[model samples]
Target: MTIPTARTTAPFDAVLCDLDDVIRLFDATEVTRLERAAGLPVGSTAASAFGPGRGGPLVLGQLSKDAWAESTARGLADRVPAARARELAAAFARAPFRTDPEVVELLRAARARCPVWIVTNGTPWLDEDLATLDLDGLADGIVNSARLGVAKPDPGILLHAAGRAGAAPERCLFVDDRAANVEAAAALGMATVHFRTAADLRPALAPLLARPVPHPRR
Candidate 1:
């Protein structure tokens, strides 16, 4: 979908972007393989780690990553050996989460034009994972939900990200793969791009970057 150019005269002051499925791509197949190797059913690992009352608290920063890992292991131990379960958890955590080189270049370009911040929902280990993907240095800042106690689709996190970028909510552009998140940001008066692919992203960001920066009042 085409993102319309900003109707206002002032260019966006910051760009807030999502991480998973946007900058870095997760491999579900690898996760499934790990689950099978651990003797758990397909999709079991996801259900145990990401379903309600499981990894949710971890993602919200209420539970420690170690605790979350232990919990996931326990859930898998019902079908596999405890040692195997723990191994599976560790392997999943260390899985190769890769970043799209094109997206990285785009992020760098966007940062040159305006402040860029990573606004993502993730556990405490997210920083470590981003570092592995060589994406930790691409943004001016990061607003992780685990540390902030809120996730996207909640306007609060989006506003918080704008604040971290030192920009008003209306002067920030939020890009995410989730429509719910894009809608939520739009509802809070932030310009949004529902990113799908590199093709969609380039056009969406073109007009924003082309607009002249707003001059400070004398």
Candidate 2:
């Protein structure tokens, strides 16, 4: 299907982008507060919740809210009783449950430059949000963690996305706000850009996007 996309001058072959902090309003501060309320040990945060001490990795399969809840439980085991795990998970789940128009526009611009592929870590319900955002034309394809049974930083998940984009790991450029995920992609031979803000992304992405090269290759 022809996915709808806005035109832009970004340069690239294939775009494998992330959703959370990159497109939506994901508040680390809020996650920290929830972690504290749940009674996790000091310095225990959402991402770190699934760190080594807990389970191997918090895998969230598409459509399984239970996976999200379990990951939350593992992260805050000391503070969160089993009964409250799902509820707490639901709260954070609401963040990326919606889309930002401005971010969507940026994605459109990027999409126009080349095939756009989304690879985000979210629950099963995220498909609804992705559809609401219109996946078909907006992305050449998608590789959400929920559907793939793996989350970021895992080579399998990254490789899974690389296959969907039809681009070798080295040819696809990955953009994620997390340093670790970006580093992980780099390890797989894909170029990566750590997203600090939309503006911060331009310089790093300019050369990789499909938009008219601002200057001829030297």
Candidate 3:
């Protein structure tokens, strides 16, 4: 709930990035994949157990991998086994990076000016996804929620990621698609950009990143 002081003109020393919906692509692609693999459309089962009409909250760190499995089984009336649901969820562990070349290029360009580390609410699967995108060269280090057992909006994970990235929390610039995550990072004294699109971030990052940018819609 605390707002960060952005009165400082100096640039932050590091960038802590979020993974899902911020750095990588996420969709219901896995639901179909699990359906084909399991010989049934298992989406509804997972949907019902998460208190109905909920997707993002149930999927992204809100429901643990185990909770997802168990809840899914109960929802499907034994049509989908907990073990199989877990397998399906695990299979969905990675989503490919968006093919937005500008985003990728901008990340590279930004990192040259300052160190960039991925600070995400995720399992070890983030490494696998980055590997899938062949971006080992792009990243310096990663902070995963599964390893830390805490998700963002919690300053602990942010501080931990920043510390490991050789940057202070106050000196890190963070990018995330979620407003809550952005606010959380900002509370820790990191500059935040709510990335709606690559173009939308330019204005927020213009002063911090040395680049020509068209004014973005906040």
Candidate 4:
């Protein structure tokens, strides 16, 4: 679908966007199935994997995705047998993900006027995941925390992203599904969109798609 245009000048110089939940969504069916087969609760595996002490290293570039999966299996050892726990962890790690087309389109529209950068707290394999969803082309630049050894809410990464987009913090519009991330961007002088749905993106990006009319010659 074609994005609508406006005459007023865009407010921001660049767009800083998140990946998970903002544009990419995961299907946890495999994780659920594995949990059920192991006689564990549906959220049990997720709790073990994402709970404190587990996901941090993986997202911070300290651990590989395989190592994280193994760590998740270890986290489940007390509740299930070793082999079953490994299976469950593998399922959760490989959960299928898809992009939000509406959000993608909005970002695409915004990109026409200014750079759109993906600034996400993600694992090292994030590029592969983006390629799988065919979303690698959408962003002009990507700031993956794992690659940079930093994550959201850290002033360094956000500043780094704004710099990558060639925009100052105050002239950037940062969008993320997490409130803490949005709050961090705001603290850094960026305009933020606490993204919950595609609807949240449209209005926040509207000003960035607007073009100011040229002044008549004096």
Winner by TM-score: 4
lDDT value for candidate 2?
0.66
lDDT of 3 by residue, 1-218 (tens): 99987664547767777766655665667666777777775465435544562333443446654565555455554666777765555544322346456666666666666677877766534455566574544557777776676777778888888888787888888888889988988888888888888786566556657644324312
The residue-level lDDT of candidate 3 at 98 comes to: 60
Give the whole-model CA lDDT for all candidates, comma-separated: 0.80, 0.66, 0.65, 0.87
**For candidate 2, lDDT tens digit of each residue in 118-203?**
88876567667666654445566667676677888888988888888777788788989989899999998887889878886666
TM-score of 3: 0.66
The reply for model 1, stretches above 4 Å from the true place, is: 1-11, 36-42, 77-84, 211-218
TM-scores across all candidates?
0.80, 0.66, 0.66, 0.88
Count clashes in each candidate, considering only residues at least 3 apart in sequence or on different chains.
0, 15, 0, 6
lDDT for model 3? 0.65
Q: Which pairs clash (backbone N, Cα, C closer than 3 Å) in model 4?
A: 7-211, 8-210, 8-211, 8-212, 9-211, 9-212
lDDT of 2 at 166: 73
lDDT of 1 by residue, 1-218 (tens): 99988564546778999988889986677777877766667877766677567666876888777777778777777888888788777666555667878878888777766789999988877777766667655899889999999987888898899998989998988899999999999998888889888776787678766766545322
TM-score of 4: 0.88
- Candidate 3 least-lDDT 10 residues: 209-218
The parts of candidate 3 lying over 4 Å away from their true place are 1-10, 29-99, 211-218
